[model samples]
Target: MATSMRATINIARGMDGAIAEILLGAVKGQNLAAERLLALSAAEAPLDSNSGGTLIASGTVVPAAAVGDDSLVTYDTPYAARWHEDQELVDNLGRHYMGDSNFQNGRKSHYLVDPARENKAELIAIVAAGVKRG
Candidate 1:
């Protein structure tokens, strides 16, 4: 036996255009925030701590504009970068290296969160500016 379920739902009529406009504005705001974060994170990331600079250099902000979602700014780096950002590790020689020990124990450089927090007001302003312009 096989079973399937389907449902139809209705939102208020004539809301499509309004909803699309709101979504576009939100996306624009998100893109602006991503741009700011990219710049701030790159500038603030600890460069001198890494031997090769790959960790700081790999920092990136994937703008929500490309993904069409406000929450989709993907701050990313290579897999090994996590150890550089947040962990104390032992090398083959049994030497311990502290990764960003100056900050919180679990966080290093905070390339993403710190910038977002520091620029919260500016991010809000970007949204407001977009709304006003629209």
Candidate 2:
């Protein structure tokens, strides 16, 4: 004995057009997310106790163009990596170093990471605002 079954999906508007609309919305959401991320990262970014420039000035965003795409925030300064990664203020020699003074305005390391983590809900909301659902 054997059993057979058949089913069909009747999409009134067709799947390709629907998928395209969703993808377009997702791109818009990603763009909004990138912009918000830049702002959040800037505020949480550790400012130099002295000049308080350069690194912050190099912040930028690359918005996504489709679903599953990446939205990136980048820093072009030479010391951007050092500043963003050195949470403990320790040098390669295993010595604690904070230059002349500590970061100003209560700012610390992981400037970009911390902000994204702390304000995750807000970031999601920003992106979700651009997406639409039935």
Candidate 3:
């Protein structure tokens, strides 16, 4: 039997979804804008007390292969990609929208939802939803 596991990553406007998928290993890295990975934003699906989601912000993503335990890696990009807390950038961007008063008031906006193979699969689905602000 064939089974599938999914890993998701969200992308916001102005964020390169293709490049993001590549960095996450959801897609391959070929002819990408920069040799270095750029940051992206994650967001929640709906704005409600019970609704939950996340957004990814633009930042540097080192290839998993380049990481060696606690060893350091080098990145070269136009925008300096600083070291960020693990998955913290995603959480932070989500908070930026969810925590805003105007967003909570039902204003409409958009968020990107990306789906891919859970463990390691190429080809991803990037869907953008028109959401009410918040």
Instruction: List the candidates ranked by lDDT, beginning with the highest.
Output: 2, 1, 3
- Could you list the CA RMSD of all candidates, in the order they appear? 12.0, 6.6, 20.2
Task: Using lDDT, give the best candidate's number.
Answer: 2
Model 1, position 130: C-alpha lDDT score = 62
Model 1: per-residue Cα lDDT over 98-132, one tens digit each: 76556432334556677779888998888767655
Question: Which regions in candidate 3 have their CA more than 4 angstroms from the true location?
Answer: 1-58, 66-98, 101-134
At residue 28, give the lDDT of candidate 2.
85
| Estimated TM-score for each candidate | 0.58, 0.74, 0.17
Expressed as tens digits, the lDDT of each residue in 1-134 for candidate 3 is: 99999987765664675444444432223212112112111221223343222212232244333212211222332221321111223354455322223344432223221211221132112211101110
Q: Candidate 1 — which pairs collide?
A: none
Error of 3 at 119 (Å): 18
Which 10-residue span in candidate 2 carries the lowest summed lDDT? 97-106
Candidate 1's clash total is: 0
**Candidate 2 lDDT, tens digit per residue, 1-134?**
89999998799759888878767876788788878888888886776546786677789998776678899998887777877777457767899865433567867668888888888998888777766741
Error of 1 at 88 (Å): 2.1
In candidate 2, the residue pairs with backbone N, CA or C atoms under 3 Å apart (3 or more residues apart, or in different chains) clash, namely none
